[model samples]
Target: MATDGIEAVFLETHNWGKSARFFQALGFELDFATDHSSGRLRNGQGAYVFIAEVPEDHKPGMQVVLTVPDAEAFRPGPDVEVVTPFEDTHFGTRQATVRDPDGRLWNLQAPAGN
Candidate 1:
């Protein structure tokens, strides 16, 4: 499957409200917000940012989300390492995590019903 491009940037924050405000101040308009736990924001054009509260035992970090034509059909080469198998998310997307050779984590995603 070919990658479409970056879908979104996922950020895990301890203080969701504060983090959302920080991004808003930077000119990212609020797209939709969930009860102070998570939300989606977009800048002019097509860039998007997704913020969510960090779960217990999870460290706050930035996750790069790449859009693929089909998440289930994306199979990394033998050199690439799979961190998490693809699974459907509550937000209506199938996602998987993989580690690059440089050890950076990337989230591969495909929109629902695609």
Candidate 2:
């Protein structure tokens, strides 16, 4: 299925302050932050970044989310790995997880199904 392009990036960090500062230094503006030490940042009209602080034991990583017009209709190439079927997210989107040929996971997101 054709995608609308990248929507946002989900990142895990060890320190919220450091991570936030790093992005801010890169011209990203804070959108909002939560008590759980996570927030969204963006630069102009570009896609935003959601950063979450994780325990030291939890390795830091980033995941890219691709915007799809219809999550249910999104079908990848035959060789693509569908790690998870479309599911409703607490953040208000319908998402599915898929692994690239390199074994990295990418999130496919679309508007919540009516």
Candidate 3:
């Protein structure tokens, strides 16, 4: 009915490959890469995170992904807007995006196979 805490944290990097490797060296495992410029790493539990290449237009920063029972059910609040509709990822998860008042993007993800 309500969103739990953060499910993942998305880090925007100029070089996703290098950032992924750095996180791996810090004890994370490469979960999968959706494409050449973006991928995911996890600590082998529930601590999965993402590394994405920032476009020239989109300001880069931390994107806190929330755990909602159903990403499809999360309606955009009063001032928020749906940036990206829910879709299945290559790594096997459902994800969508929303924007806060300040325009910071937040990714909402449902567990893989849900």
Candidate 4:
């Protein structure tokens, strides 16, 4: 099945408070937060931003999350390259990663029970 649409843009930041405040200053409203470590923010038009503290030993990066009806059913065409296989995440979602021709990463996710 085709992907539904962009789900959320994820940001891995070293300073959660500083990054969150930066977005907030740009007019994004906080939708929810978890322990000041991670949060979901939304713009007036409904676009979402998901920020989380960078994990130890992991380099910070931006990830564009795409939503699909069922992650297991996603089929990358011959031209697309798979970086990671579909798997269940600790956050309770099914997801996979793929790399585009220029080497940019795309994260495909399906909500729990999808």
Candidate with the greatest TM-score versus the true structure: 2
- Per-residue C-alpha lDDT of model 1 across residues 1-114, encoded as one tens digit per residue: 667888889889988889989999999999999985999999986759999998768889887888888766776788879899788898788888889889888888987765
Per-residue C-alpha lDDT of model 2 across residues 2-97, encoded as one tens digit per residue:
779999999999999899999999999999999999999999997899999999999999989999998877878898788998899998999988
Clashes of each: 0, 0, 0, 0
Error of 2 at 108 (Å): 0.8
The residue-level lDDT of candidate 3 at 75 comes to 65
- The better-scoring model by lDDT among 1 and 3 is 1
Candidate 3's TM-score reads: 0.61
List the candidate 4 regions with Cα displacement exceeding 4 Å.
Answer: 55-59
In the range 10-105, model 3's lDDT, one tens digit per residue, is 789887878888998999998889756998899966757888898768877887888877765666666668788888998678888888778777
- Candidate 1, after superposition: displacement of residue 96 in Å? 1.2
In order, what lDDT does every prediction score?
A: 0.85, 0.91, 0.80, 0.87
- Candidates 3 and 4 compared by lDDT, better number: 4
Model 4: residue 114 alpha-carbon error in angstroms: 3.3
Question: What digit string (tens of lDDT, one per residue) describes model 4 on residues 68-99?
Answer: 88865777789879898888899899898889
| Model 2 stretches astray by more than 4 angstroms | none
If ranked by lDDT, best first, what sequence of candidates would result? 2, 4, 1, 3
For model 3, the stretches where C-alpha displacement exceeds 4 angstroms are 55-58, 71-106, 111-114
Task: Give all candidate RMSDs, comma-separated.
Answer: 2.3, 1.4, 4.0, 2.2
TM-score of 2: 0.91
